[model samples]
Target: MTVPTEEVAGAGAPEPSAQPWWRSAVVYAVYPTSFADGNGDRIGDLRGLRERLDYIAGLGADAIWLCPWNPSPMADGGYDVSDYCDINPMLGTLEEARALIEDVHAHGMRLIVDLVANHTSNEHPWFRAALAAPVGSPERERYLFRDGRGAHGELPPNAWISAFGDSGWTRVTEPDGTPGQWYFHTFAPEQPDLDWSREQVRADFDAIMRFWFDLGVDGLRVDAAPAMAKEPGLPDYDLTSYGDPTVFRSSVWVDSPQWDTPGIHEIMRRFRSVAREYGEDRMFVAEAVVSSSQRLADYVRPDELNTAFNFQFLKEPWGPGLRDVIDETLRLHAEVGAPPTWCLSSHDEIRLATRLGRTDTTAVHLVDPATAPTDLELASIFHRSGEWVSLASLPGSWA
Candidate 1:
């Protein structure tokens, strides 16, 4: 859908850097709620974001990866997008979004927004239509809806486990009020995985890309990038097998039945093509939590994404473990000729400051701020901020 906006001219921005903007750029991730409150509503909005552009620019950021500003149920922190083209009413309006884009570019920085491609909010229009449609209908095919394995359809279709620690499949009630098919969700049940095998699903994403690019977004950060494609036949997977890191393939999700499955590269290539149509510098940075360095590199092959989050590096504790990961990452990415990407924090993961103070440093899950260690300390236990900055001095770092 075309996101309507009045004429908003790009401000007088500086020339592009000698290198690709993202290569040596510090892409700042801005979560909307607490960044600033422009309307005195105690929540962040585009107006607030604009007001702080000078402050952000002062920090020497090269781009802003605005965390999900799309209309959503707030499940998964706005990753459950209900409308891909429009801004969340709480955050701002379409016009404000346009102005924010212009403001961002005007400051000589690019804007990257989230593309929750692997799934949609359960309340999405297409998903609601799918729920209303009968089994075996085309609407149902747009998502991963399958009949239950049991005789009365009482059980989940497979034993697939969600990252949030529940059955990946959720059984739904039919329109006639009967027990019905189970739908897949890699995260919360509020977000249902889209069936990329469906052409309409893929096409809609292509349209979504153009809509944002037209609005002047410089790139897209693909949410749940690995889980886009799944193994065929909805087969049950051996959960125990996943614990053996050595056994995992270069794709990370090969034979896993869900993440980074066989056809994900093709889907990413399709996404890349869409971005390329806009411009070569219009790029994609995948949020890929893969099994190994090789798997991470595979996601950023030239034909696929321009870069992917170096999650292994993020999850490593300081010292030998961290060094090994960096070495391995550089080696693998060098092979693919893709610039390695690194990040300190992400919407889905714990902040670097908090994680650094934790006893179990490499654990990547988000913990309640109160329950987790307090902010990064200057004590003997925690590594200082300067160390981290120096370590991440190379290109493709996100803050």
Candidate 2:
């Protein structure tokens, strides 16, 4: 299985010292909602994060990738951003966020925040204006709002499914309480997908990037990076024809007009330029959930994002499958001269220990909520020295 090098050829190389700090850094992902609750509000806030900075620094993590702390409605676990510039009041004020950054820097650790460019909360001012505006109005153009299919315009515009297991299109209610056009949402309906084809959308993201970068954010972890750019003209797809729809490896998922399109690379390149304007140390990492190693590598090319999460490694089972994914990830990243990121678990994923102790370890285990091991089973795995050694071997870093 020979890997192609054309995608990386002639890519402008940065000087070794100018390389982003994330290349060999251990970045600990912090879910701010649960990390700690400093104000006794039963919800974690910037104060909590600030209080725990020492613990994170002591853990030897070079940086901390914070999940969305931006003002959100808590829909989709804070992925539905309502305001890009302000911090969530429930989380803390903007002053606290700034102080957290200063504290992180004081602890000798860098800070990166999640950037959800693919979608925005339904409560966002732009989206609210879009709901009131007539179809084809300038406000509507900010999102992927389109006329529904069928004679009565009752059917969805396309056969696309949401990542959360439902139709991707959500019909809106017009100001006069009439049925309205449907809008695309890759995730939940509250999180409507933005129409990246619009220059205004691109410009808005550029401002959002600068807003954080200028405030001293070290990096951004772009959420749903690949889905930002969709193939023109939403098309119907046959989900049944693809084997194992649950696995991203299925052709239905990979070849869909909705994901990993070539246009997304250009969008990423533009984002790369924005990061470059900040300094060599500023970085962008993509959360592109494609199944192919080559497709994943494309996201981290020299002129694109600095790195991307290796979901292939995250979803692989123990033994040969895991080893093969690690090896291929290292090789593919090497071809692009990019570093690979590794993780056993994330806020959206089950804990690493529980996942490894289960009898069936596959992507299916993740989707099936009931597949978790019993308490005794988990205890047994923890008590075994051999299991501990095997679990330790599962963590892989960039070579």
Candidate 3:
């Protein structure tokens, strides 16, 4: 498990200035709702973001990575987008959104909108159409709908578990008013996973990418990047080996049937090609929780994505030991000629201050993994071949 720092010095890696602006830019991430409030509604909106443009510029941010601002049920903090072409009513109209993007650029900063292509809100028009269309209709092909197993089709089609700790397969009642087929979702039931294998899904996603890139979005922060593609046939697994399915983000890592599958690279390549249409500066950064450093590197190959969040870095203990993570991360990204993005915290992670308080100076520090729930699965990512690392040793290791 020891990483040779000499072989991968300055794991902080290269000077990517010769590349796109986004390569070395200091991106200030904003969870729109709490960033600022406009019009006194107490929820952040595009108008508010525009108003803070100067303030963000003052902080030296080269870009703004805005979390989901599209129409949603707020089921997963706006990640469950019901519509990709418009803004949420609560967030402001499309016109205001355009104004914000303009303002962001005016301040010499780029805008990276969060895109949840992996799944759509159940309320999305396509999903609604899929629901009303017959089980085997063209509409159903847009989603991962399959007939359930067992007598009367009462069981899930597979044994996959959701990231939210439940069965990934949810049975849908037929339009004819009887118990029927199942649809898969990696998160909440409000979100339905898209069938990336289907032509309609791929075509629609390309259009969605164009819709935003045409509006001058510099890049996209791809949510659930490792998902969207699943192992074909959706095979069953012996869940016990991966640990508790109820553990948050801890299940389905090793030989997972739901994520980081072979087909995801092709999907990324397709999306990367779309980003390329907007020129070299228009990039994509993946939020992929993969099993290994090599797998993480694959997300940013020449024809895939531009960059990806080094989430595994957050799992390393503070101080000297943290160098291994930095070296490994920088080494992988360096090998692929892609710059890596690093951060202590993101919208989804626990704040840094709280994580630091749990560790001591001497000996091995028992930080987040020691104090938090056992099912936090970052442990599996660091699991090297023929080595069994304990879940309690990793720091801040959840998805």
Q: Worst lDDT window (10 residues) for model 2?
A: 7-16
Q: For this target, which candidate reaches the highest lDDT against the unseen true structure?
A: 1
Model 2 Cα displacement at 285 (Å)? 1.3
Candidate 3 C-alpha RMSD relative to the actual structure = 9.9
> lDDT (0-100) at residue 380 of candidate 1?
37
Q: Cα lDDT of all candidates, in order? A: 0.79, 0.79, 0.76
User: Each model's RMSD to truth, in Å?
Assistant: 4.7, 6.7, 9.9
Candidate 1 regions with alpha-carbon error over 4 angstroms: 1-18, 243-254, 358-389
Off by over 4 Å in 3: 1-18, 246-252, 358-399
> lDDT score, residue 85, model 3?
92
Residue 213 displacement in candidate 3 (angstroms): 0.8
lDDT of 2 by residue, 227-275 (tens): 9988998777666666644333321266778888889999999999998
What is the lDDT, from 0 to 100, of the residue 337 in candidate 2? 88
lDDT of 1: 0.79
In terms of TM-score, which candidate is strongest?
1
